[model samples]
Target chain A: MDWIAVADVVAAVLMLCGAFLVLAAGVGVARFPDLLGRMHAATKPQVLGLVLLLTGVGLRVHAWDVAGMLFLVAVFQLLTAPVAAHMVGRAGYRTGKVDTSLLALDELTPDQEAAERAAQDEADGETEQADADPR
Target chain B: MSPATPQDAGWWARWRHRMRTQWHAALWLMVVWVLLWGGVSVANVLAGTLVGFLLISVMALPSIDYRGRVRPVAALRLLGFFVRDLLVASVQVSFQALRFGWTPHGAVVRVPMRDTGDLYLTVTSVLTSLVPGTVIVEAHRITGTLYVHVLDLESSGGADAVRHHIHELEERVLRALASDDELAHAGLGPQGTAVADARAVEAMAGDVDPGAPSVTPEEDRP
Candidate 1:
């Protein structure tokens, strides 16, 4: 077996798999039930897909500099993607974008409702301040 | 500008503290800069370091508690488990989306973390979302609760499984990043009741256990 040819085949497989994952992510986002689930679809497969694609490109490039840059991209993606998802999910939940009724079992709503009740008992100015600030 | 003046003393101290907290980010940016420039030379390294420090200092991040020690063995295991779960869940979710006539059942679970610290809670939350099956809907910092939304019950193995997985994930994170003292404080080591103790303290501090069904309002607030 030609070693170079074997390496090329592996790279090709990685790229194809990466492409497939991105496609799957698109479909999942389109089909998932709620905003949070769609956010999951948007982040989950894309992370692995980006890593795999970067690895494949790095393999084919055969240069340390470009490969290092690709590695950085992967690392940054891994670090930031979930944080972005978390922010989006939190926003979606707060803005009433997430359909709570669609959820089979919701532990969050009860707490949220409870919090709202507690807020109602507070004086008017403090209630407005609580609504404005997450911290 | 001058470090010798009395006014400069506080400024120098503050700058040093900022550097101490921001050195990791600065170093990471410097490495990225050197790599992107392709091939490291003395000039390239110097320039990268200068740019990294300048950028970080100008856009300073809020300081985080950086007291944890990275346990190589536990960190490696956590990485391995994370990657395995990532692969498995991504494949399963991808296929589940592709399958016809099979609607997924989703649920939201509240997992109260053992470790009350923000760093431990953060790492666990990041890992949970990165793994594909669960997305955190809400995270209460004081109470140490993460309200996670699981994509599919069948794929995710139900609410109890999700809770177990979250607790286990938190444990792994605590092992990887938390110091021994912090671990013991979280109730993971030989002597532990920190979670309960922390919750009790928080409850006393006016933070009620809102999500826990078993804990009554009377029990938490008083």
Candidate 2:
């Protein structure tokens, strides 16, 4: 077979794999009960799937210019995906969408407890700092 | 009149200093410009550079704050580690999804960042989020703690493992990027107490087992 044919086959395989990953992510989001678990479903496969899809496109195109643009797409995705996930997860936590009992461990409780104690102390006129920050 | 001391040292020195501070950003913007246009040529390079300069000048881009020299060797090692984790975690999570009636005993475990600087905090959060099973839910800036939701938590001890794993990742990233002084901090040193901490937390959770049936009868009804 010619090199063009080989490249085409490889690209097809990559595209298929990428599509499968994306599908898996969708299934995960639908099945997961809580918001945090669903966030996991949302992020991991989607980012990797996008990378795979981009790679498949780049291989098929076989042009330096296209490769550069594809690389940029990958870079920007890498840069932004985690931050977006972090935000969504945080919002879920604040809004009480997360079921804490489902988790094996929770470390944020102690911090919240400490904050409550400090607030109690402030109410009792123990501390003079007016602008106490809990976060 | 300009300052008589360093600024007036020479035009060439000033130019070199400017390049040192600005070159990384300039190069990044140029690459972005090329990608946007989908081609590279002399005219594109000139236009990209001009636009980059104009944007940086007009927008007052933040100056680079050099934390430490990034060790390329360590960075490559971290990249390899991250890629490995990505593949492994994705497969693990996908399988978790495929399993019938599988309930994840996930938890929002808090990892301490009291020892790490601000940069380490950012890196740890981003890296953890990128990995499949965990995402940072909250970051307590003053105390330097991160609340991370970990998937597939099997037992109480798993919390410790998760925390230790995050610290291990942090150590790797810090080695790659943190300055000598930051690394020297005693709290940031070594992944020693990870196991011990897990055991301790497990002990603290005497009555409440993670993933045990804590739901009321009404809540339990599917």
Candidate 3:
């Protein structure tokens, strides 16, 4: 095959892969059991798919600077997407929207746990004194 | 001479510190944006910078205390993992799509989260959403519950497996950002067990009934 033809084939393959990835993210959003899982599906593939598609476009355009810029876009996406997800997840947690049954340890707010422990200790002390005094 | 006055001053000081940090983040984002657009034109760069600054200023209210500076290497590692996972999931999902059509058992699951700060959670959510066949529907901020839609609940290797996968993803994020002590205080580490258990329960609830119709019949139809 001529070089141009070969380039076209490669670009086509990359584009296909990118499209498939985007589709996968859509499916993941539809199929994952929870928000977190779905978010995982959405961000990762979207970033990669965009990267792949951009790479294909870059190849077709044959512009080194544009391709390099596209690479930077991918990198910035890699950096920012997680930060956004983290903020959303934390907000969800603090608001008490999370189902506790999904957790094994239930770290319950630290201050609340500490207060409970202190109350229990005081109650125990009072009971011991009452028992000793036999009132 | 008043304690309240000092407290107010302290608060403002903290606020200013946060603002400064945000400004730095804004500057970085502007640079990245400019680079991404691949324009050396002064007008484009100035406009991009202004937009970035405005965004940061508007969203400058400090909520979570993320103490450390950004670590590029850690961020890179997370990106690497995301890329790897995406490729694998893409292949697997494509096969399923081709073979079984689009209708897969779908359910919304609530996943309790460990207290790993806002940043980590945001990253986790975005990463998870990027995976094929999943979507983040709603995140309950108070309860740390993540409501997600999933495909193929029956053949999706059970809820426990899914929970495990999610936990691993979160763990990676925590390791990337927070120190051990910070993680512990955030109710991460061993305390995260509770969150994991809760996820398992939710996953079980999400198990699709085989007899029930799949959600995406149109996509699945050959």
How far off is residue A29 in model 2, in Å? 0.6
Q: Give the higher-TM-score candidate: 2 or 3.
A: 2
Q: What are the per-model DockQ values?
A: 0.60, 0.56, 0.11
- Runs of candidate 2 exceeding 4 Å displacement: A116-135, B1-20, B155-157, B186-222
Q: Write the per-residue lDDT of candidate 1 for residues B119-163, one digit (tens) a residue.
A: 888889889988887888788887777888888865675665677
Local distance difference test, each candidate? 0.77, 0.73, 0.60
**Native contacts, share recovered per candidate:** 0.67, 0.69, 0.17
DockQ of 3: 0.11
Q: Which model scores highest in DockQ?
A: 1
Docking tier of model 2: it is medium
Q: Rank the candidates by TM-score, best first.
A: 1, 2, 3
Chain B only: TM-score of model 3: 0.64
Q: Model 3 compared with the native: what TM-score?
A: 0.57
TM, every model: 0.84, 0.80, 0.57
